[model samples]
Target: MTAILSMLPPDWREGTFLGRLDLGEGPVPVLLAGGTVHDMSGAAPTVADLVDLGAFDPAQGSVLGSAEDVLARAALLSPVDLQCIKAAGVTFAVSALERVIEERARGDADQAQAVRGGLEERIGGSIRSVVPGSAEAAALKAALIEDGMWSQYLEVAIGPDAEIFTKSPVLSTVGSGAVIGVRSDSDWNNPEPEIVILSDRHGKAVGAALGNDVNLRDFEGRSALLLGKAKDNNASCSIGPFVRLFDAGYTMAEIENAKVLLRIEGPEGFLLEGESRMAEISRPPLDLLRQAFSEHQYPDGIVLFLGTLFAPTQDRDTQGRGFTHKVGDVVTISSERLGTLVNTVATSRDAPAWETGISALYRNLAARGLIGGRA
Candidate 1:
């Protein structure tokens, strides 16, 4: 309830949103409609089941209270439960360049600036303008290869295939107002603010939420194979506030033009701000979704993180060393439609351990007598 105004969508009453709320007992699916919060656990115990049900009529459940009242008292949770957390990387030209910088620098923060300047000068324009997988992209690829500047990151950036990977475990993501972690050993790390799509089992986007894909540039820069370590960590993934379901007033088109804003306020008076315009994304969100769902199945649904365009290069403390997170830094990611997701940074070693899994979720649901079937 602290700074509650900044947490929910500005148009909370107009936009139909879905989220999980824990009012002491356990996490349950909740719906915000016409400014009222409805307990959806009676209709569907989990948000994933609610998605499978394909309907969010408030009339189907008992009213908890007004949105303002409920949100103040209940603990907000990540919008999706039981869904695989997946993310698309290098979907934006700037992000692609940043990845290249990380790669060329070999995760060494001191070498980033030098590598970035030359990399951008050589290929930034083409990467920015050429459509991915297009003939122009292919030509650019051939040209880069000829010049010996081709990279694995470039292959995913302009090549036919996109970079999609499992971001974290199903129940591991922390919600808004929680502590997001960065590995203590990582010398270069930052948050990747993104628009996460909540999709059904068939890969159809149902709603969207704000997400922070906490990234460790140094680890992945050391080796592409280190991506798993660079990304997944205790309290690494932060999502929500709420999932704004697509409706007449808000749809995919709104998301396509959403300008995501990021602000980092550090304890030592360090402040950094940046924005990611979805309009500049090299690949379409739906296209990324298709690549993610190509041959895999998410029976319980999936939350796909559309890659970020804002890659922080601003100096945090050192003269030439790029941005990196510090403990106690408050990171905020927000957009007009998705409201705000705010979290304070902490080292992964110090953050709370993830103890709950799918089994615990089912047991809790059964204990409440809410797990049998959709009502």
Candidate 2:
């Protein structure tokens, strides 16, 4: 458990911590370091109290004050609001597989070819998207057809409106929080350790931190037409503890090899657990984000998820009906230096049941893929 300090400059035992906190009014940016906390409300106020505050300047700095001086009983809602988020596209092969399985469950016979084309058009080659594949489209085609895991992903073709390899970063609004409130009983939710970077006005990644890029599996199956339904939801996106600033001297490649781990638990036991590196990711984080920023604007600020690697192929423990996340499943996504984002599973409002015959069938197939157990 190396402290996050190692990721910052040696002179400062801890880099200036920036995030949002609830100080009665609502959520506002705040800083924590050396046993003290500073509020940034005077600079950028809450989303509800937003005014013509110009632009959110992370460098405008914070107002000096102690948490006790303000209110000792205040909740720590310190992860600052990034005006927009560019939801990551398929940056991992495993994720691609997950989408394919989802379409297959939806009864797409050409799912494999569709997924393969997405790999070529949206993700393949630096000229197109950031999930770099060979310049020779044939190479990617060969790999998809020859690789067993990939072959399985292509069993059903991707729908015309799939979100796999779109060059631009997709807009998303889920924010930082401790609870994930899905909308369905069959929400196949999984947490992945994602490194989120705050973009400068020019779209360069100014800093990074640990993130939980929550995914709801049910939506990916319902339709490939749009990802907003599957990926974006209330309290689904979260990042925090603090942001480690990235100065010009430092390069995004420095964190490219960082280790990320995912862990999920129900009353029964661990459902998903594994470790992977940013190196395993096909899309370059900065490039993926830069392209996304090229089209979108965030006067306040924006957070970009790099994408996920490993996740359970199927559902795990539950009370009775085999919906993925139960009422109290705990999920922890972590980075040794950046720390962890732990959240509890809960649902928002009463929702219709989606774990009917088809969902169960897909879950069983995914579970069978892990027959020998977790790798």
User: Candidate 1 clashing pairs?
Assistant: none
User: Tens-digit lDDT track for model 2 on 1-375?
Assistant: 222323223333244455555555444555545435665555544321122242334345465565345435455442544346555655665666556556655623224334445545543342223224333434555555565434333322221111223212222222233565565644465666688776655575666777776666666666755456555555555566566555443347656888888777786765767776788666667666766666656565566777766656443533321235676677776675565666676664432222223234234324534122332
lDDT of 1: 0.91
- Weakest lDDT window of 10 consecutive positions for candidate 2: 155-164
Best by TM-score: 1
Please state the error at residue 121 of candidate 2 in Å.
22
35 Cα displacement, candidate 1 (Å) = 0.8
What residue runs in model 2 are displaced by over 4 Å at the alpha carbon? Answer: 1-13, 43-72, 107-133, 142-177, 247-251, 314-323, 350-375
Off by over 4 Å in 1: 372-375
lDDT (Cα, tens digit) per residue for candidate 1, span 33-61: 99899999988889988999986898888
Candidate RMSDs in order: 1.8, 13.4
